[model samples]
Target: MQSDPAAMPAPAGPRENRAVLVDVALALVIGWILGAAAQVAHWSGQLAPGRRHGPGPTGNEAGHDWPRWAEGMGQPPPGVPWPALIAAVVILLAVALRRAYPRAAFAGALVGAIGYVAAGAPFPVTLIPLALCGYAVAGREPLLRWLPIGVLVLPLAVAGWWQEAAVGLTEPGPYGVLLITAAVLASATMLALLRRARRDAHDRERREELRQAALGERLRVAREVHDIVGHSLSVISLQAGVALRVLERRPDEAAAALRAIRGSSTSALTELRQTIAAFRDDPGRGPTAPPPGLDRVDELAAALRAAGREVTVERWPDPLGPLPASIELAAFRIVQESLTNVVRHTDRAGAAVLLRRTGDELLVEVADDGPPLAAEPTPGGGLHGMRERAEGAGGTFAARRGERGGWVVSARLPIGEAP
Candidate 1:
């Protein structure tokens, strides 16, 4: 199981829910707007031309009548009685289900269209429901490239051609209805595909970010292990050597050395576990131990002092203000790792640590007054670990030969505003 939040698929939040509702609402709004536009075009034409194409009753009315189209607006095309109201209900149901069920929505829209046609309603009015389902079909159905245009557009066009368009109201002609239906469905389909493409792109970016975060997290754990176990091992090795040297003639000194080894090992184990658990978080569970920070720097120096190394800590600005845990922890890790390298690589008992708060940044430098380092500095796990810790905490890190002699490790870490 992935422990990272970025790795998990996001739940549909309020914004997504609102978006779905908006799509459904837009169906109704778009249909009404298109219906009204058709009305406007119908009214734009003269009543004389409409009388040519529009149906009417006898020879006297039909001859030279051009046609007999009525001009009005009602839910069921201005005639055909109260039974035609079911068409509106079915169309509304189709619109509501468009996002959730494309096939079913399409079926409902078709049924409603058939109902309106059966009621002697204008075919252009029925095209509204059919066009509304385009979004759902284009988004969810396969063969989507031309499927929506073919399936949705052709039907509305055919129905308009077969029926007297101005059944009760002067509506758009078959060609007008065809163009309007195709335009709506095509627009809806294009919009749906665009939304899908954007969503897929967003998901890809999120996954890439999660991959990078997981990689960075793993590196952080490795650094923690190197700092914790590496220092402990170094201390343990030194203590063991001392114990061996004094065991023959001085039992008390050897016993004290053994105690130091035990202490370091136990502390290392406890902290190692805490660091591991911090990353492997679970519901209602958290790291049991507080992370080591600058407050523990004195304790680190004291430990080195007891281990026969003279380690001194100098803090400029006397005392730092309350610091962010991240900055403090990074500083502590750098100091710890730097001191460990001094013991393991240099045959010296003296190392100096400087901590200074400079504006929005904190500067930490650890320099050992030992013999000069190699001209070509060899890369080691300890140095790499220290560098990673500093940079990982949004800091700059460099380890080079000191001006005078020995090795100097410096880090400049960003310190955000204190709580």
Candidate 2:
């Protein structure tokens, strides 16, 4: 089915439409008030005698006919020096329509200005409507679209000034019209540029926010993948080595080692699927299981032991109680990554895991009594990941060589309301 292009809905949202309506309405009301004031000045004779271009007498004793300037330029039709109320209505309508149809509104306003001048209208409130239309045009249309309008309006304005001056109404020159036109165009252009700059700043801010969100999400996925795959693979490697060593004599032990490897691999696969589902934004699926935390430190230590490391866990103050889930998860990952590093780099090194609460902070430390690995760690490796995880959870992490001659990793995590 064919659809008419003219029937398409505007891209502006409801909020933007309302804002435009309010602005246009305010401009209309302001123009009407100014026009009304000019009408009062005309009635009170505050303005010059011949300035009112109406059909009635100009109050001049000579009783001259219509001015020569009114010959070529069209005059308002009969009964056309509209009352203040009718003029106000026309001005209001023309100003209000400026936004959606800037060119048409501006042209209509210019015609109205000509009629108002020919009618000898008391005050030139029409200039307000024209200026507003120019502003709207400058804001929405490109320079090429409205630049010609500016160029054309200046000459017409100069002619109007010349007519006023020729009749002894004001000083004779194009300078007055030139000044007014320049002011109007400059004001409109400045406002339009400011609005454009503000919108550009807002757009840049919005794009930056989206980019940061995406980067954070990617970092989260990377952290999860590292913790799950790295830990499971480390366990599988140890079990596979045990199985190969025992296959000749201890058949049952070898079989047990193979079963452990199967369990670790299965667990790794399940977690990987969950991570993938999360990335795909699946509604029905959530995290497959709660994240490992401090409560699972013993299980983690046992796994490290199985990986051929001597591991000891010490908890200060007996019962550590419950902590925030984020803190617990960060602590667990720190210990897990530390253990993994020891297993991968050290040969049966002894490591200690410590958890303690002091003041408003929970401290977690992992240290291995082995020389640092000779291989240079890659950027954003296990240690860097652990530090990011801890700091991102509103904590502080530090890793340094222990006084006893081994690498030590420590994190001080806030428990509650601690800076």
**What lDDT would candidate 1 get against the real structure?**
0.71
Score each candidate by Cα lDDT: 0.71, 0.71
Give the clash count for model 1: 4
Q: List all candidate RMSDs to the true structure.
A: 7.0, 6.3
> Which segments of candidate 2 are over 4 A away from where they belong?
1-12, 23-59, 62-78, 81-94, 103-123, 159-173, 273-288, 372-380, 417-419
lDDT of 2 by residue, 1-419 (tens): 99988999869999979978886777668666756654544443333223434345453322244433244545422332254445455556667787778777666666555544434453345567767877777777787876766655644454333345454335433455556656876897789878977988999999999999999999989988998789888878887888898999989888888887887789789878776675776678655676667888897777666645689999996678777878888998999888887777676677899999987799999988987644434445898899899899889988877666567889999998422
For model 1, the superposed segments whose C-alpha errors exceed 4 Å read: 1-60, 63-90, 110-119, 141-149, 161-179, 210-218, 273-289, 305-307, 315-324, 347-350, 356-361, 369-371, 378-381, 392-394, 414-419
Deviation from native of the Cα of residue 373 in model 1, angstroms:
3.2
TM-scores for every candidate against the unseen true structure = 0.71, 0.77
Model 2 error, position 79 (Å): 1.8
